[model samples]
Target: MSNSNRTPEEQALMTKAAAVLPGGSLGNLRLDEEHAFVVREGRGSRVIDVSGNEYIDYLLGSGPMVLGHAHPKVIAAATEAMMKGTTFFTQNAYAIELAERIVEAMPCAEQVRFVSSGSEATYNALKVARAFRKREKILKFEGGYHGSHDYSLMSLAPSGNTPFPQPEPSSAGIPRAIQDTVLVAPFNDLNAVEDLLDRYHDELAAVIVEPVQRTIAPQPGFLPGLRELTNRYGVLLVYDEVVTGFRLAYGGAQEYYNAVPDIAAIGKIVGGGFPLAAIVGRREIMESYDQGSVTPDVYVPQSGTLNGNPVAAAAGLATLEVLREPGTYEAYHARAATLRNTLQRLFDEAEIPAQVSGIDMMFDVFFTEHPIVDYRSTLVDKTLNRIFDNTLLDNGILKSPGKLYVGACHSDEDIERTIEVFRLGVAAVRDA
Candidate 1:
């Protein structure tokens, strides 16, 4: 493997980062030494590295820059808010306004509570569910990623062939007892989920899922079936919309799929590239967050120092305003569809055993002939994927390890350029 062109300054920065940061990364996007490059700044749909090499960025800061990096409105909103003050730890107007916007957009959000990250949001959501339902256990899809909390880490990426309804801890330091609290089921398999619910619904406080499991879109009726099963069994349904929130639609996955959940942990685009997240749900259920409204044992004692940072709320509000503009989704979806379809067509014509698995806005090529419906089905050629991703990086196209996040800021030119790189990536995989 050849290292891409790297300037001395860039090399020095990487060396410094490797010396301090764990595994030379912030534990998000990790590239091999050869392909790794430190990003200096991002504007619109492109990010510039310290080496002054510019790449059309499809990672979009892991799906937060929906309106693209350094958006003028988002910057202005954040800047204006920052000038007033950063954080008061008390209720601020920006946070209240942002919460109102969230309730207005999300179908299930009659009440909202802010957190600093998606992990906190999911953790608190689960806590509230457990409190509301008076149950200790929760059911999550095998591959669904809610966040890095102990409950969310269960069966997130189990290497072993763990059987249904039995969770294997995906991370170390998680207590053995945590395994008993989480039940696992296959994604997109309604029968499996229903069976698990039937057997363990009494113990399950909630059934949490990613509306789009990683890059794989939920099968039609899969979400609705989950809702019905959870309702029938008197278990709460939770949607981890950290990625899909405000990206799939103004109302997130619930609005896009027309299947609402009882509670949702949302982040990513809702934060407008900042570290902000929220747990939104029905008024009755959310009452668990209010200490005065609930019994001492049932009330969730949740508080974060930077939970409702005014600057992040301001940025989030600006992002939502832009998304609400007329014809935004129509135009954005059309552009993404064109790019996704063209890539799939290219791979098919090349006769490569690939499946462009995901919705138009977010997707990646899985180098397998078999259909990608669930987590186990996704165990395909990782080597081929590495080659394809590296090829795109070499050609100035930046994307995440598993998915390509198409942004609203991707211009016609960016799409065209990305498609050309996709062809190169496909050919590289085919030849390999």
Candidate 2:
């Protein structure tokens, strides 16, 4: 890391975190400068920074922690699990129980294989799709972040006639060959996908899409159209439900939108804020990985030394138990509606070209008069968007800056507080 890139405190942690983890992706905003707010602890919708500043946390760890930081139920479950021996490396009862909850929650998830993170789930889903279809290419939407894996890295530039959409690695160190096997299409542009399918459907194994684009909602019929079109093309459809799973509803956005995919990759709230994820789909496809199958045509070997770890499964089970309650989703919808509407009205009254994009508990504030229907539309007015992000961060409210996520723990008071912050933040940014 550059000296210019690191603050004294950041420099110390960067040295440690980099030595251990890949010095995780830093935001585009100058983190060490104005935007750097080191978190110490959290309770409900508020997080306290190291400096002892309490901020209403809308970032929500980039959309996990939906029950919010250290919910009593989740914490207790984790503590109990920890006390009962952390990792057994053997199948645990909680694993089966959590999988049962997932199967019940996601209408499309018939059989599930658990993993540690969203990236692993999405990556494994790609492998399953290929094995099922016996194809080579994977069609992905531009700017759709499935994971840090090779195939999901291709990003379409904000320009026209994007060609040969091989995986343009989103990060350093990914092999360039990934770009060749991965194809890119603009989100919501079904015709563009058809154009590519004309030449490559036979070779295309799967088409993965975020039912609701992260930070943006899909236009009506967009997701169903994608499902229909992919089914028509014999390409496996994978819905990346990492952000929209329980956050959208008990059954996820696929069920909420009534667009069932061949496979579903889920993360976030499923683990009760623990490190867990899943790739779930039809019985036929998932059964190919069953070890005892005679002459298994597609031998899919999936093992995470920590796959289906007991403690995480226990936490996940506890989280889903609460989410499954009657009217649980209803409360999330009502609260989200209040927050989105209040923010939208604030932008309107301020005469700012800002719009809130979300459904249920997830949303993003785009600083544009026009609606952000897809990734292509997200790039317009980049300057104003940057200004809007900085102003909100400066006002002692914590949002993702890319996409702010509301949670089950975000109370009515939190909504009011966020609206107040948004009003001041919007005005401050507009003037600046």
Candidate 3:
């Protein structure tokens, strides 16, 4: 299905949007005019465009809508909390409860500090690590996205062979000094990380990584190796689990992989589709956030007005309760696995040279025969990826350009329709 014809009202909105917003869109997505749409609303694994065209939503609000759009339980919780009041600058009961839940659920969390976004969580996690260790430099993996902060932007999507441990700034405004503070290494390459730790441990505060580096699963021994080396170096290990937390498992990647880091940043599902994120770690490490607990020199001053919005926390608590239901994860995994395998099979049967990469819960096609083990390897067939994703949109399937995020609310009908879309998508790619 090419995009349904836009109504006059929608066309006017797009024209208005073009005049007002940068790039005529959100920074996250830019679609061709023929395929562009403004979402009217979303419900249970589906989104309707302003033109009244419904799409099977694989984007899932970029991976936060795990229970799908407007889940009843979350709505009720948030609505009730909204009735009470939106937010208070002072401590609130719901935030405390949510903090308790995070500390209980996250393997690395003995204490937690709330924040308003995943970017803030990662930035604060790094700041706390620096405060604790009295060190300035941090090591992050190539292509590991930790958010848009200056330190996190280093080598996020560098295409150049800049050699190991050299930071590459993908964005322009980042100060040149940031390149000196952040070191880059390849994901899943233990030897490179060991070398960097050996040489720079004295100045390094921590090593931050995405355990599942943007849909590229960690190789056996990788996470353990990172934990061991960071521990040995007396440097912190921070897992940027904003995408993987609760999405991967109830306790996040540290629990799923059985390799715990010193601190972790969590977001997405934990917020129940709201703008809440958290930084969690061991009690001693977390003391940096408590001015009274830490010496003046090492104290981290962090405060946000909406850090613990009652409505957001109530919705998150309700979401976590729903996720705790028996067999919920199994069902979610099973549906995702079915889609993953079917898509892989579709590509194979169509004789298209592609690899279905990532875990069942979040995966996508890499249009190449080569195994996708790192960011550099993923560069192969980049053009094909663009074609395939655009084809999916043409067929009424909405997914992120990089990953297809699955949610628990997908019905049998949704599954069947998505699978049929997969076949058509692959075939279009095969012919293209």
> Where in model 3 is the C-alpha error above 4 Å?
1-4
Per-model TM values vs. the true structure = 0.98, 0.91, 0.98
Model 2: per-residue Cα lDDT over 182-233, one tens digit each:
8888787878878887778899999999988777778788888888788787
Query: Which segments of candidate 2 are over 4 A away from where they belong?
Result: 1-32, 156-161, 164-167, 294-296
lDDT of 3 by residue, 305-360 (tens): 89989999999999999998999999999999999999999988988898999998
Error of 2 at 59 (Å): 1.1
Better of 1 and 2 by TM-score: 1
State each model's CA lDDT, in order: 0.92, 0.78, 0.90
The full ranking of all candidates by TM-score, starting with the best, is 1, 3, 2
For candidate 1, write residues 390-423 as lDDT tens digits: 9999999999889999999999999999888888
The count of backbone overlaps in candidate 2 is: 2
Q: 2 or 3, which is superior by lDDT?
A: 3
